[model samples]
Target: MKTNTEVVTAAVVGLSGWDALVERYSRLVWSVPRSFRLSHTDAADVYQCTWLSLAEHLHRLRDPEALAAWLVRTATRQSINVLRLRGREVPPDRWEPESTLPTPEDVAIGSDRARRLWAALTTLNERCQRLLRIAAHSPELSYAQVADALGMKVGSVGSTRSRCLAALRVKLEASR
Candidate 1:
C-alpha cells in the first residue's frame, strides 16, 4: 500500500493516485459524521462532499504529506455543515430507539462523565476541538500534518495542545 505521502504526490502529478488517496482516507472521513450520530445517508453525503472538496483543492493543498489531516479537517467541517442544514429543518418529535445498545465497555464510562466531557469539548473553539480530536484519534499524524490541517505553525502544536487542554480542564472543573 502506498503511504499517504506517495499517494498525494502521485495525485499532484496527475497520476492515478487519487484512488489510493480516497481508499486511504475515506474511512477517516466517514468517522467524522459517525461520531456526530448522523444517519448513514447523511454521513455518506458528508463523506462524498469531503472527497469532492479535497479533489477541488488538492492541487493547491500546502502539504501533500498532510493529506490525512486535511481530509480529517475537511470531513469535520462537512459534518458540521450537514448538521446545521439538518437543524434548520423541522425536527420530528418521535424518535426510534437505536437498534443496538452500546457495548458494556462503552457503558462503563458513566453517562455523567461523558456528558461533562462533551460539554467541555464544546467549550473549546472549533479549531481546538478539531486539533484535539484529530490528535487523539490519529497519533500517527506528525506536527506538520496537524499544522497543515489547522493552519498553525509546526512549532505551536505542543503549546496549543497544552492551552486547549487547560481550557478543557477549567471547563470540566467549573461544571462540577
Candidate 2:
C-alpha cells in the first residue's frame, strides 16, 4: 500500500490524487471536532473548513506523511474557532493543544487510571485478562482471530467478552 505521503504527493499533481486524499482523510477531518463534543452542525462546518484550508495549502505541505496530523490540528483549531464564534467558553484546561503530548495533570490522572486498570486486570484469571487486553487494544483482531488465539468457539466470543467485562467492572467498583 502506498503511504499517505505518496498518496498526498499524487494528489497534488492531479484531480485523482485530490479525490484520493479526500477519501482517506475525510473521516479524520470529521472526527476531531466530534471528539470535542461539538454539535453536529458545528462539526460539519469545521470539517468543511478544514478541507478548504487543506486545499488552499496543499502545495505548501513540506511532508505529505504529516497529512493526518495536519488535518487533526486543523480540525481542532477550526472546532475551537467555531465555539469561540458562538461565544461558547470551553474551559482552558479542557482544550487539547496541537501537540499531542499529555499535560502534567493529564499524565497524573492517566497514570492513576492505568494503575487501577492493571490492578483490576490482575484480579481476573489469566484467560480473561488476555482476551480483554487483546480485544481492547487490537481493533484489527477479528472474532475468528480472537477465537483461534484463545482456543474458543467464535460463537462464544461475544458472551465471553460480556462476562469478562462484567467481571472487570465488578473488580473496578470493588476497588473504588
Candidate 3:
C-alpha cells in the first residue's frame, strides 16, 4: 500500500491519481465527524462534503503533500457547520425522545473529571480552547498537521500546547 505521503504526491501529479487519493484518505476524512459524535447520517454528509471540497480545490492546493491535514481541517469545519445548523432547528416536543447521537461536547467531556476539565477549558481564551481541542481530538495528526489545521507556526505548537495545558491546570485547581 502506498503511504499517505506517497499517495498525496501521486495525486498532485495528475487527475489520474484521484481514486488513489480518495482511497487513501477516506478513513481519515470519515473519522473527523465520527469523533465529533455526529450521527451516521450527519457523518456521511460531512464525509461527502470533505471529499467534494478536496475535489474542488485539488488543482489549486498550496501544498499538495499536506493533503491529509487539509482533509482533516475541512472535515472538522464541516462537522462544526452541521452542529451549528442542527442547533438552529426547532426543538422537538417534550414527548419526543432525546437524540441518541451525542454532541461533540458530550463526546469530549464524558467522565466527571472530563466534565470538570471541559468546564475549565471553556474559561480559557479562544486560541487556547481551539489548540487544546484540536490536540486532544486529533491524536493521529502530527505537529505539522495540527499546525496546518490551526494556521499556526509548526514550531509554536508544542510551546502553545504546554502553556495552554498549564492554564488548564490552573483553571482546574481554581474550580475545586
Could you tell which candidate, 2 or 3, scores higher by lDDT?
A: 2
* Candidate 1, 14-90: lDDT as tens digits: 75888778777777898888998999999999899998998888878887778778888888888899889988886
Model 3 C-alpha lDDT per residue in residues 3-118, reported as the tens digit of each score:
65666666667765778888778889999999999999999999999988887787678776687889999999999999999988876663455686777877866776778998
Q: Highest lDDT: which candidate? A: 2
Which is superior by TM-score, 1 or 3?
Answer: 1
Worst 10 residues of 1 by lDDT: 92-101
Q: Please, what are the lDDT tens digits per residue for candidate 2 over residues 32-84?
A: 99998999998999999998998899989998888899999999999989878
TM-score of 2: 0.48
lDDT: the better of candidates 1 and 2 = 2
TM-score per prediction, in order, is 0.49, 0.48, 0.47
TM-score of 3: 0.47
